[model samples]
Target: MHRFKILFVCMGNICRSPLAEGIFKHMTDNAARAGEFEIDSAGTGGWHQGNPPDPRSVAVAAAHGVDISTQRARRIAVGDFDRFDLILALDRDILRNLRKIVPAGETDKLQLFSRYARGIDEDIPDPYYGGREDFDRVYTMLLTGCTSLLDTAGKLRTS
Candidate 1:
């Protein structure tokens, strides 16, 4: 009866990570699989702590039928390493940063989000400084990646 816990990470929680969390949550909920997983997101830094996902991110997700409006920004906490079965980083830089903070023996939990995405960009670039299209592009990528992420998680559940 253990839920598979996942924590998506990026430079700031207001952007990439929240979108990932939202997309995955929305997908699971729609598939009637929400109870099988526990999903959340955080940033490598705490700059946007307590703030909701960026307006652009919220809008983008909303456009795609997913509401990320209520997700608040937070930093990658120490206990998260132990709490989550997977800690997925949106980009290599964030993955590297996560490596530095992950506690010993828990390193196996860390992975690049794009690894689930085959034949696509290896990083989900930050769209914080760009215009609406940037957020849209990231959304497309997340949709693709999150789909694969859920597939992988399902396999892990069975094995």
Candidate 2:
């Protein structure tokens, strides 16, 4: 079976992207489709490299029964363009950064994570400086987006 690889990106891997990765992984695992996908995350910047997700992010995911505490922050690498079937950015700026670094011929793989979820036509807000409510909001956005993303990926896999 060919596994579809998905990579989520944010400015810092300690927040949004890690949440997306955890939510997507949890959803796929629950659907018994975990083996059919390769889900991971990275950041557009490298400041947090080797660091675990922010404590708030870990707490938010844990509240929803998904553990993202183990995921480490990593900067986006050139090889990721070829490694992932889908490269989803948390916001427009991240997408632009990714576009600037993506090798030619791989631009088609890049997209905004919000494209998957209806009504959420903007970037997932960064909650790094906000309170619990912000993290909760981000978690809700990620959940909706990841659910929609999995649905879309499943269709692509079948076709």
Candidate 3:
């Protein structure tokens, strides 16, 4: 079977991107259990390169029954542009950043996560502010996006 590589991106790897990574992993793993593809994530900035995701983000992901504790934050490498089949950005700035570096020949791999999501017509709101509630809510928002993201990946894989 063919496995598709996916990379989720955000400004800082510590929160939203990792959360999207985890949620997407959970959704894809479940799909794999029933037959599906592969997934991963990264950040556009290297600031949090070796750091773990914010504890609050971890707690929220755990609440959803997904384990993201072991996933360390990493900046998107130049090579990742060639590696990932899909590159989903969390918001506009990162999307713009990705566009700048996505190589003139490889820009087709980039797409906003929300564009793949039917009802979510905007950016995946960053939840770096507020508290646990913010993280939890962002998790829910990303959950829908992840499911929608995977459903799209599934179709391309089978077709």
TM-score for candidate 1, please give it. 0.96
Q: After superposition, how far is residue 80 of candidate 3 from its true place, in Å?
A: 0.8
Query: Candidate 3's error at 109, in angstroms?
Result: 0.8
Which sequence of candidate numbers ranks them by lDDT, best first? 2, 1, 3
- Poorest 10 consecutive residues of model 1 by lDDT? 112-121
- TM-score for all predictions? 0.96, 0.96, 0.91
C-alpha lDDT score of every prediction, in listed order: 0.91, 0.92, 0.81
Report the error of model 3 at residue 62, Å: 0.5
Model 2 global lDDT (CA atoms, 0 to 1): 0.92
Q: By TM-score, is 2 or 3 better? A: 2
Candidate 3: stretches off by over 4 Å: 33-35
On a 0 to 1 TM-score scale, where does candidate 2 land against the true structure? 0.96
So what's the TM-score on candidate 3?
0.91
Residue pairs in clash, model 3: none
Candidate 1, 12-118: lDDT as tens digits: 89999999999999999999999999999999899999999999999999998999998999998999999999999999899999999889999999989988544
Task: Flag regions of model 1 displaced more than 4 Å.
Answer: 117-121
lDDT of 3 at 123: 88
